[model samples]
Target: MTLPTITATRYVLPLREGGSLPGVVEGNDLGTYVIKFHGAGQGPKALVAEIIVGELFRRLGLRVPELKLIQLDPAIGKSEPDFEIQELLIRSAGLNLAVDFLPGSFGYDGSAGNPGDQAMARILWLDAFVANVDRSWRNTNLLVWHKNLWLIDHGAALYFHHSWMPAEKFATLPYDASDHVFSIATPDVPGVDAELAAAITPELLTEVIGLVPNEWLEDGDRERYLDYLTARLDKRSAWLPGGAR
Candidate 1:
């Protein structure tokens, strides 16, 4: 099923910590969301990565906040005094990506206790699968809500897609797992890889890609993205910990 799109009703506050200048927006659906703007320095590619990778995690049975397409109205930026934010809001006065806001959520200090072996392994494996380079110790990009770990800030994943090289060229690239904030030790990498391999089928990948809006696609970019992901999924052994076996 596809996610619902909602119009932002109110801009509550800016999340200064995020590099993209995401803001807390109240949607017409009576939901609070953390929105990522299309005009951010990272560009629309970041939003695409967020939707694809985040949905992939959800399909894998992992914990991630619900995502939505947020429609931003420029009038909301007129009241803002910050020139930078006002300009960004004006530029991004269109469709953007938002994640459901979890109240009382706190940054993961790596002290709320471990996520266990299976969970950690699956997370690491997914990171490797997508070549996410931002999950280091310095910025976990993870949140704690209701005593469970929730993944967030996935715009940095899928870096390989940004390059001009043919997708197959980077499909075999190696991913360094040492910097992962959560320890990868003792996790069943091979098992998780096998499970995900079976679960992330062709139809599922297409569905995840379909979540992205057409306006975000430039020329053949969407088809290229789908081709790259499908190719990587078929040749996952090169990037995955264990061979695709």
Candidate 2:
């Protein structure tokens, strides 16, 4: 399995754990990172939100936080909301500032408008397909470090809780799959502003895709993802229908 470059000895810190415990590592030179575990299930899942969805969004060219998986143990650190969260944060060999964020410039209510709607619509579609339900403002798990919208926490995707979801609950799944949302509530709601879209160069997409955790994708998924984005960027008419109007 693809894992972050970590040390034989690890240091886990005990911080207040809600969704994830903020942590620091000693080796590999990777700064702060979120951590998670293998095959984690809901209610009992090691980590909550911020796994596949976050990484996948990054692959699709959204700004997402740095992530990695680390060795786990209470001795390494205490106060684990769950092992999954602990593993992701601690294992990441990169800087972990995932602990902070403010809207405005991050991705919402900016002097312009939503940071990137057509792109976000794809994120929403991906989330819907994977069954992630924690992207709203209340949980905007995304962090805006250095004036960029970074996605965080996605251990909550891929419909793990379905094992217990009742027949009535399944209805939402069908509704979520619909494309009515692939656009926006109104056609005029310009997404992210033209300047931002104009600035999203292939180099930026490559850089963001490079950040995607290897473990999240099956081999070659990265190339396919990059290809998918190239196709999407080439076909902006589908994502940014408002622009056509």
What does each candidate score in C-alpha RMSD?
1.6, 8.8
Task: List runs of model 1 lying over 4 Å from the truth.
Answer: 242-245
lDDT of 2 by residue, 187-222 (tens): 433444344445556665556456545544456655
In TM-score terms, candidate 1 sits at: 0.94
- Which ten contiguous residues of candidate 2 have the minimum total lDDT? 94-103
Q: Per-residue lDDT tens digits of candidate 1, residues 21-133?
A: 99899999999999999999888889999999999898888888999999999998887899999998889999999899999999887789988888888888888888898
Native-to-model Cα distance after best TM-score fit, residue 78 in candidate 1, in Å? 1.4
Give per-model TM-scores: 0.94, 0.49
